[model samples]
Every structure is written in structure tokens, then in C-alpha cells.
Target chain A: MRRNLAIVPAFNEADSIAPTVAAIYQWAPDFDVLVVDDGSTDATAHRASKAGATVLRMPFNLGIGGAMQGGYIYALEHDYEVAVQVDGDGQHDPRHIYELLDHLREDPELNMVTGSRFLASSGQGFQSSAARRAGIRIFSSLVSLITGQRVTDPTSGFRMTNRRGIELFARDYPHDYPEVEAILLIHAHRLRSCEIPVLMQPRLTGASAISSTQSVYYMVKVLLAVFVGLFRRRPIEAGDRPAMAVEHAL
Target chain B: MTKITLQRGLAIAVTLGLLLLVFELVRRKRLSERYAILWLVAATTLFVLAVWKGLLTSLSHDVGISYPPSALFAVAIGLIAMILLHFSLAVSRLSDQNKVLAQRLGLLAQRLEKAEERSADARAAPVPGKRSALPDHSEAEAEAPVPAQELSTRR
Candidate 1:
């Protein structure tokens, strides 16, 4: 009954999606793949479907946060035991997906596992642009200070969530600059999380959606979002939650 | 006409015009009654201030503003700011709902594609005496999953 789902949120990545889907199926054949095509004008949905993955075509672009939330809702509705997020741009190595799953399986208490390139011994293969690196560093420190958990790559899209995490996100999720805020939300929900070293590949095609000039705006907006999250009321009540099934290992 | 009547008359006219516009929009079903309340309240307040010149003058004098006409401008600016703030709130709520709708659409679309695939597979082959469960080609496709495997072979 250990059903697993790999949620790939792609936006106009026609060139990279086919291989990315192939890589995912090859690396993790047991998992069912759901590609949330984020309103790509190009042939992204067609290409993904051809690549042997279930494609969820958005009528209009809903950014990363909305797309991923849709994936979580699907997972929840389908009763997927675990849902892992893998970027469709081919930046995240699906080979490391097993490692993330392993961390989640090994610890039933942990609700999430994030793939971080900057984790100690992570090999530091492809550090992003200088501006992005600095922004990540600042966000990492800010999130760490608030959550008391040292997150090396707060901006990493490569992450996995359990049933608890999925339900929490399906109810409410950050719409803009989600990765970092999502980490904070996980902490707010009092869910456990861990990060392991994972290699990040350079984007196979298309420049980053966030341009160099937008970095400043990105920083300010993210910082504001994170701080606002600290004061906002917690969505889930701790008292009324049902106890999770305790299992030793997968 | 004196300066007072010219300025006050124009203010009253504009306020009345706005009030009438709101009523027209609501009548045409273009503006919701909920939003019309804000516009109605704003226009009514301005009309009151424009018609009662003494209230405007006394209020400005009590507030230590030397000029009475300037008070009308001040109140109008303040009301405009409040209306803008209300609009900002409405836009934020609409965007949040829009995101939820988009998410639901994506999920439902995926489910539809899957159903389409299953029916398609059922129709591809027929049992020797039994009719194809799905007679309609379009219907089968609706229930069947997209033929992703076929596209993979093309490359």
C-alpha cells in the first residue's frame, strides 16, 4: 500500500520535459508520475504525455506554487502515500529521488525531505548565478533563524512530502516565492524535515524565469512573505489532529 | 455666478453624477450591489458637504484649516484613498480564488484524460461475439488516457 507519486511541475519546458520524464521513469519505475503542465504554449503537455507521464494541463499559468498545490491535491485525492516534487526543467537529478524517499521512509516522524545542493558534502557542483547565490544565502539564514533548522538551500524546488505535509499544503500554500515560505510553513505545522546533499544540473533550456534585475524585487518580496508568515495565524489546529499510523520502516 | 457657487455647484454635480453612475451600473448588472454600497456612501458624503456650505466652513475652521474650500479637497482625497484600499482588498481576494480555480482545473483535467484513455483501450479490441463495450470512438477517447507511449516511440 506504499503508493508513491512524483509531481513534476513544468512551465513551457518542451525541450527538457521528455528527457526529464524519461529520467524519472528510468530512475524510479515504481512511482506514478504526474506532470502539472503550467499553461505552456509550447508542446509541453503533448511531449510529457508522449513521455509516458500523466499530464495535468492548466488552462492558464498559475506559477510554481499553484501548480505544485494542484499536484498535492491530486496526491491527496488519489490516496498517494508519498508525493515527491521534481522540477521539469531537468535541473534536479531524479537519481537522487530515491535518497529523498529513503530519508522519508527511514523516519516516520519526518514529514518532508528537501534536496539541497549546498548541504555539507553535497559536492557543490553547480552554484547558481552570484546574485541568486547571495539571495539564497540570506533567505537560508532568515529561515534558519525563525525555524531553528539550518536550511542550506531554501530555494530548492526538489522536495518530498508525506500525507501530513500534503494535506497541510493542499489546504493553504504560498502563491509567490513558495519554496522558502513552504519550509517555514512545514515548521509552523510542527512537522519534522531533513535535507540531504543532491546535485543540481544547469537548466537544459530557457533562462531562469527570475531575471537579474528582478533579483532585488525577488529578495524583498520573499523577505516580506517570510516575515508575514511568522505573524499569520497557524492554519492547522494542533489539538484536533488524528494520530498518524506509526510504522517502523518502509 | 460667484466663485463659491461655481466651485460648490460643480462639486455637487460631480457627486450626483457618481451616485447616478453607480445606480446605473447596478441596474445593468455590471456592478455588484455589495460594491455599490462603497460608491453610494462616498457620493452621499460628498453631496452633503457640497450642499451644506456652512458645515464645510465650520468643520475646516474647527480643524484649524484656514481655507474652507481646501477641506472639501482634503475629504475627497481621503475618501478616494479609502476606496482604493477597498479595491486592493477585492483584487487580492479575487486572485486567491483564481489560483484555487486554476488548481482545481488542472486536477480535473488530468482525471478526464485518464478516463478517456481507459475507454479508448476497451474499444481498440472486440471479443468475437460480444459488442465493443464502447461503440463511440470519441467517447472512448474521452475515457482513455492520452497515448503517451506512442509519442515516446516517435523520438
Candidate 2:
């Protein structure tokens, strides 16, 4: 039996943290839930712990990237074979975790599997605002063009990874608005990542992390990060990992 | 002649003042020796330029600048830029280390909590024959004991 972990990064999501943690447990009983309380001022840590999820309370806010990297580091240290990121705001359906896990298990070559809301099968899920959707489309096309694979939702945080992906992310991850750049990082390391259709719900509570005023800034920053990611040196070659090669053979 | 002498004296005085300020900061441990070296070099160069009447003029002429004072301005700007850039690099490194420290701290805290819970569980359900699952006496013994007189001094 493979060890599985669900990493939920939350910041002041006191209203939704407990239910989100519980839902992940309900949907995937085998997976150990680890909620990263990103220095929430509210009772998020307490509620998450009460919901039976192990909580790693950061001393201060390091944003989403730092929080998720903490979870990845924990997963790597604990030797979890598979780890899935479930947003604490409850936008990501926990049921889709199985689908992502199945993709990773089925294709050993696939390093990561992201749950995309724009897939045809995803249907009429909450697909963000029109402006953000346009931004997502631009990034989707850019990533698809660069990776030579179709990418519908490059900004989706709902993703699962194998140990190889875990090691890669644990070593190096971007700081702010990292989802799009993370995709480019996967490409840089010559790792395989694909998107699967998943229904996303509207935020259970609280507002979206990116406000209208910040959306323009977010778009420019992410685009710059992506372009810069192209020039970064590849830290790991595809053939370097003998362990992954053996696993693929099996 | 008197005006030129007064200008030279003022320049020398300002450079001397800067050197003394650097020395004072280093002596008080406010500025580190690593950074003090750069300031020392800057002050000494300014002192030389101030005392040497024809040095700045010749250097400016060699660099194709008509004005010697503007050449000094350029050099000062360059030095300031270098120091600012160095500070930026230090700040970037510090923030990176801070992030790593925070992550490690959070992980360690979680592990410590788990270990404490396990120990609490052990103490709560003590076995019959084994040594009681009390807190390890060795941990207490590891600390150096304060003398009774010293302990009572504050009270």
C-alpha cells in the first residue's frame, strides 16, 4: 500500500477549513490530511486539527507558494509515495483526488496530474470571471505552445504528484502566483504533466486570493515569471533518475 | 588663492569627518568590519582626492570629462550604486534563508507535538512491569543547577 498525503494550504479560511478537511477525509479515507495553516489570524489551525488533519502552522504568512512548498517538504520527508494538493477554500472537489491519483498510478511516466476546470467534460463549473478566464486562456496557450501539449488550465492548484514530482518541487518552487510558473518548471526539468477534467465549486467562504485590482498585476507578474522560467537551467535531466526508470519498468 | 585653499580645506574636513564616522560606527559595533572596509576605502580615496590638488583634474581629463567635480560626482554615484546593489543581494539571501527557517521551524514544531502526544499517551497508559512512563529524569539532570543563594537573589 502506497502512502498518500493531502496537502491543504489555508490562510484565514476559518469558515471553510474544517469542512474542507473533513471532505477530503471522507472522499479519500486512505490519504493522510496535512493542513498547512499559513499564519492564519483566525481559528483555522484549531478547526483543521479538530477535523482530524495534522496541522503545520507557519510562524508567518509566506503566501501560497511557501505554504505548498512546506507541505511538499513534509511529504518528501515522510516518504509519501503520492501527494495531492487540495485548496482549503473548498473550491477543489476532493473526489477528483482519486482521478489524479489514478492518472499518476496508471502512467509511471507522468510526473504530475492537474485538475483543470476548462476541459470539455468539466461542464458548467465555476470558471472564474470573464477577465480572469481570458488571462487563463492566454497562459494556457502559452504553456501548451511551450510544452508541446494541450493545457487547458495552467493556473489550477488542484494537482497530484508522484515522488519524483515531490522531490523536484521540494527543492525549488516559485514564491508568489506559482501555479503557471510551476507548469513551466515541470517542463524545464523534462518531467511529464497533464491536465484532467474536474468540476470546481465556487468558494465556500471568504474572497478569492486575487482581487480585481491585483488581477492585472498578477497577470503581468505570472507572465514575466513564465518567460524567465524558460531561461532557467534545468536542475534535473529526465534520464538522471535511475529510481524512476526502474519504477517505470515495473 | 585664498578661495582655492578654503575649498580644499573644506573638502579635506568633510572627508576627515566621514573617516571618523566610519571609525566610530565600527568601534561601536554598529557597522561590521566586512562593510567598514568598503567605507574606509571610499573615505580614503576621497581624502586623497581632496588633498591632491591636480589628481582629480588629471583623471577627469584622461576620462574626457571637462569638469573635474562632475567626475567626483560620477565616482560617488558609482560607489553608492555598488553599495546599494550589495545590500539588495544581502537582503535577497536573507529572505531566502528566512523562508527556509520558517518552513523547517513549522515542520519541527509539528514533529515535536507528535512526540509529546506519544509520550503523554505512554504516561497515561503505564505498563505494569516496565519502569513507569514518567518524564525522563535524565532530561532534568542534563541542565546545570543554580546555587540556592543565586536562585534566591532575585526574590
Candidate 3:
């Protein structure tokens, strides 16, 4: 038996939210799910509620950063032992959730585990548009360069976080392009992070917020945010072995 | 007594002076476009009345005095200041609205993250010993939380 919290931020996702919530019930029945419906013009909130998910409806849409940050706060308040972010568009495979959580549960120091479509390294289950994938790769490379860790899928929205990750995120989740900025944030806080292979389905319903224009903005803004974070981070305790190296050696 | 040309020249000078002050005020953000219009209108009208004192002064004084150009200029300046002050208050209200929107968005993110977790749980086999989340909900107490309680570092 396990106790976990899943944060699902949705907007105009009426078509797939019910099935996504239903799938979550199938993957981890013991976990409690909360829907942060960010002012959906559709019936996303009502459907999530009917599906037995606790709905936290925002008065207006605040994009991905605000939605995910809400989940971090909830995780902190309710004292969830493990927290995972599940996208509302039904792209993420909830089954891999157990895998991501398992890694964190095994080690107290490992605070963040993200689901990476590229971790499998087999190109299977990669359904994002070519343009989107190209953008993801660019950002992933940029994050890897900044953090000194190769994050194969920097934009992967699916993640499992420990108490440390939750606290850090609750404080300063990026307003947009949370995945990239969140990686930098995890590094800034001296938290350990890893990416695990996961299946991502093509969105069954609507368009993504990461449009052509948004992709350009996401790249520019996230890069700037990462640069600022590097300066803002408290001096990493001198000569402390990097978390990944230590975790891997152990 | 002053010559007609001299009096008319002074009236134009007073109007120009007020107009110059307005240009400076605009640069400092002390006055907005809408309010500036009223100031300019009042200033110009006073200038016209100053030169044609006989008609304006007939009621107020015996012959040569009217609402003096300089006095009317003072009133317009005061009106602009009051109008600008009110505009400042309006900007402050907008700032407040932006703050509230941001706070609510933060709360929404927390709820969405929780929903993602719940949805993940929906996928797995239901087991016993589940821990209660959202202690804010009274119903949470009845159902035990899952053994997978992964709270790594509690404060």
C-alpha cells in the first residue's frame, strides 16, 4: 500500500480528463487525485469531480506554471509522502508513475524523478510533433549544459517529487515552461533528479499550449530564467559530491 | 492704462506659459492624455476671455477686469492635479487585481498537481492501508492512505 498525491492541471480538456482521471484510478487506486482546473471553459471541473477527484477550480487560467505550483502547495499542506504530476491531456502514461515514485522512495536524498520519453532510447511511444520534439531537444540540451546533467527530455511534464522537490516547487515554480525551469530549480536547490523512460500518447483531444510562437518564447524566457537561477542559487556547499554521482556510485 | 496690443500680448504669453507647463507634465507622467485635454481647453478659453475683457468683465467688475488670465490658469492647474491623483488611484486598483489573480493561480496549480496524482492512483490496483491526503477534507480520515506514503523529508 502507498499514499501519493497526483496534481492534474487542466484547461479546456473536457474531452479526455474523465478518461485520464479514470486511468489514474486504475494505475494507483490508493492515491488521492486533485484536479486544478484552471478556469476551463468546458466541463473539465464537473467531470473531474464526478470521477471522484477533488476539484480545486481556479477562477482564471494561469498557464502550466500556476497549475503545477498549486499542486506543490497542496502536497506541502496535506503532507503527501510522495507527489506526482500527471498531465490532464492524457498524453502521459500513468502506469510509469509507480516506477518514478519507486526511485524516490528508495533513497531519501533523491528528490526528483521525471518521466523522459527519450530515456527508453528506442524512439517508441514518441508521439509529439517533429517541431515540438526539435524544440524539446534544444531546451533539453540547454538545461543539460546549465545543470551539467544530461536531461534527455527536459520538457517532459510527468514527474514524481519528494518533500524537498515539493517545497522548492511550491516556492518558485516557473510561470511558463515549467519542465525546463523546474529542472534548473531542482539543481539550484541541490536536489537530486533523474529521468525514467515513460510512454507518452498523442493528445487525444485538443491543441497544446506550446504553439510555434510559444515555443520561441519558451526557449528565450526559460533560458533567461535558468541563467538568473544560476546566480541566485545559494553557493553550492563547497566540494560536496554531486548528488547524481553519489547516487550512481551507491 | 495699458495699450490694447500690450494687454493682448500678455494674454497670449500667459496661455503659452501654461501650455509649456503641460508639455513638461506629460513627460513626468504627472498627467494623462484625457485630463490634459481639459487643462488645455480651459487655458485657451481663459486666454480668449482675457483679451476680450469688456464682455467678460461687464458682470464681474465695472469695465477692465475679468476672471484674470493668471487666476484661471491657476484653477486649470489645480484641476489637472486632482484628475491625475484620481488616475493614480485607478492604477493602484489594477495592481491589486493582478495580485489576487496570481494567488488564485498558485492555488489552482496545487489542486491540478494533486489531481494528476489521483489520476495516477486510479490506474493501479486498489490496496488497503492507504493514507489520508487533503486532511482539509473531513472525509479523508475514514479512508486510510496507501502504504506507498513517500513523504521523504517532513518539516
Candidate 4:
């Protein structure tokens, strides 16, 4: 069974949720859509559900990281074979879902694959603003040094993960700047991750919550998380190890 | 009555006083014990140089420095600067760790809320294994699609 799910974490994305979900359906009908609504005050959950997506409303706002963590938890609990992350801000073009899905279809060892805005082989992937580009470069360098592998788009929210990656993240995903630190987390757990070029649209909703100060907060916290991971006791190792079913405990 | 004996004793006193300051800091947790070694060295060096100017001047002359006090003060400042930088790094680490802990707390609270909801739903109704005890609270409202039925010929 190709039980693939696209996990879209949305907060106050009322305007974009319907169109984004519709685009997902048009682009990849086979992939089930799960919208992890982070306790949005707007009609994000309703709109997403109306547009034909599974809605998991967090009790309250848990931010982007918490919302995605909930999606991973759902995937783990329901035994989803594959789970991919798509932004709910109407940024990730549904057209690129095929390109990402193709990578998974090709290799089973590829546990996690990210749609990189900077990895365009044809130089036709989405273009970002200058500040975002700089932030991505800085965070990517940090991930590269820590993971001992090059990562072009460290903060790209467009990512796909197999069962193994989903379970790993469900157990221990970063609490903040998750899309960036997730690369490090996946690496620390010794999982294979790949990045491919994908198309993205500009955000189609309200004002962005990511300010300059927030970017600094994001970078510093992620770097600190990497530093702290070095001292964590009994780190996880990737293999056919026993899965950590932590829903009840959590 | 008190020649170089009191001067030598005063020099030892200042050095020991600086060591005591480092010890006090270590005891109360203002300074990490590992980095306290550097603090101890810095404090002792500054105190010794302050008390024994003649010895430092002679050594400075040997090392071919014109202003011995300025050189010694610069070294002390450099040591202080390095220590401050290290302390700042520790502060940065602690700040994010605090945020991570706060995030974890929020997650735990969410779990607690879900648990309460499940318990409430279980108490409200009892049935065989069909659905979950947790309440299915739809997060989004209004904009979510209504049922596709109910004589919707009018737009």
C-alpha cells in the first residue's frame, strides 16, 4: 500500500488552507493530506477539512514545530508508510510533489527527502527573498558542519519522510525551528536524507510572523540544540531497532 | 618595625584574597569551577603585579617593554575579555535550553489537556470498541466545508 500522507502545519491560514489543499489534491491525488492545525483562531482547520484534508486541531497554539510533531505522532500511530511535509501558507506548489514522490519511489533507503529551493538542477525552483536566502545559507552551514554533510536549504518546510523518519521524529523532533533542526535530528539518528529541487509560490495569506529577531532566535536555538545533543544520554541509533511508541507516555 | 616583611605579607594577602574571591564565586555558583582556574590565574596575576611593581618592572625590562604596568594591565584585560566571552557562550546555551524546556512544558500541557478530554468523554458515555474516548474537536471553523447535501440548488 502506498500510504503516503502530506502533513501541512498551518496556523491562522484561513485564506490559504482551501486553495493549498485543493492544489495538493490536483498535484498528488494518491497522497493523503493531513493538516495539523496549530490551534488557529481563524478557520484554518475547517477550511482545510472542507477542502478534503484530515484536520488534527491541537488543543492550543504549539507553533510550527509542535504542529508538525503532532502530524508525525499521527503518522506513527496510524502506521503511515510515508509522510511528507508541505507548508500551509500556499507556498509549496503541488506540482513539485511529484518530483519529491519520485525520489521515494526510486529508493527505499532514502528515509527523508526535502524539497530544496536552492537545489534546482534546472535553475527553475522557487526564488526566495534576499534575507531568507541569507538565513538559509547560514543555517545550512551550521547543519553541514554538524551533520558532516552539505544541506542547501536547512529551513525548507517541504520535506518527505518514510516510516522510519516519521517514527524517529515522532519520538524526538526539535521543539523549535524544527524544519532546520530536523536535518540535524535525522542525521544524529543516522538516517539518509536527500534534497531535490521543487517549485514554491509566495505566501498567500496574512503577514509573516518570522521577523529578523525571530530568525536570530531560530538560529541560536537550533545551534544550541545541536550543541546540547552532544551531551544527551543514550542517543538513538538507526536500524531495525524497536520503535519507540511514545504516544501514551507523551 | 615593618620593612619588606609586611610588604611581602601584603603581597601574599592580596594574592590569597583574589583566590578567596574565586573560591567564593565557585562556592556560590556565580562561576563554574572548571573556568575558575582561569579566573584564579587572572586575579592572582593582577594582584601580584599590583603589589610587586619592582619585580614586574625588572622582568618587563628583561622582556624589553618600556611601560611594564600598561603591559601587565593589558594582559589582565585580555584574560578578562576571554573569560567574558566564554561566559557569554554559556549564557547563550542556557537561554535556548530554557526555551526548549518551555516548549516541552507546553507539549506536556497539551498532553494533559488531551488526557482530560479523553477522561471526560469516557465518563460521559460508555460503549463498546467503536470510537476513541477523546473528543473530536475540529480546529478550524466556518470556512470548513459543510455537508454537500441538503437541497443546495441555490448558490
What tens digits encode model 3's per-residue C-alpha lDDT throughout A83-140? 8899899998889888887888887889999998887858789658788778788888
**Collision pairs in model 2:** none
Using alpha carbons, what is the TM-score of model 2?
A: 0.84
Model 2 residue B84 CA deviation in Å = 1.0
When sorted by TM-score, best at the front, the candidate numbers are 1, 2, 3, 4
Top-scoring candidate (TM-score)? 1
* TM-score of B-chain for each predicted structure, in order: 0.75, 0.74, 0.45, 0.63
What C-alpha RMSD does candidate 4 show over the true interface residues after superposing them?
A: 12.7
lDDT string, candidate 2, A1-250, tens digits: 2389999999999999999999998999989999999999999999999999999999999889989988998888877889999999999999998988888999989999999999945457889988889999999999999899999999999999999888888877788898998888888888999989999999999999999878888988998877866776664332222232123222
TM-score computed on alpha carbons, candidate 3: 0.64
> lDDT tens digits, residues A49-100, model 4?
7897877777677678767877887777655788989889988888888788
Number of the top candidate by lDDT? 2
Query: Which parts of model 2 have CA positions greater than 4 angstroms off?
Result: A121-123, A236-250, B1-10, B127-155
- Residue-pair clashes, model 4: 2
Q: Point to the candidate with the largest DockQ.
A: 1
To one decimal, what is the Cα RMSD in angstroms of model 1 from the true structure?
A: 8.4
Tell me how far the alpha carbon of residue B135 in candidate 3 is from the true structure, in angstroms, after superposition.
11
What is model 4's C-alpha RMSD? 11.2
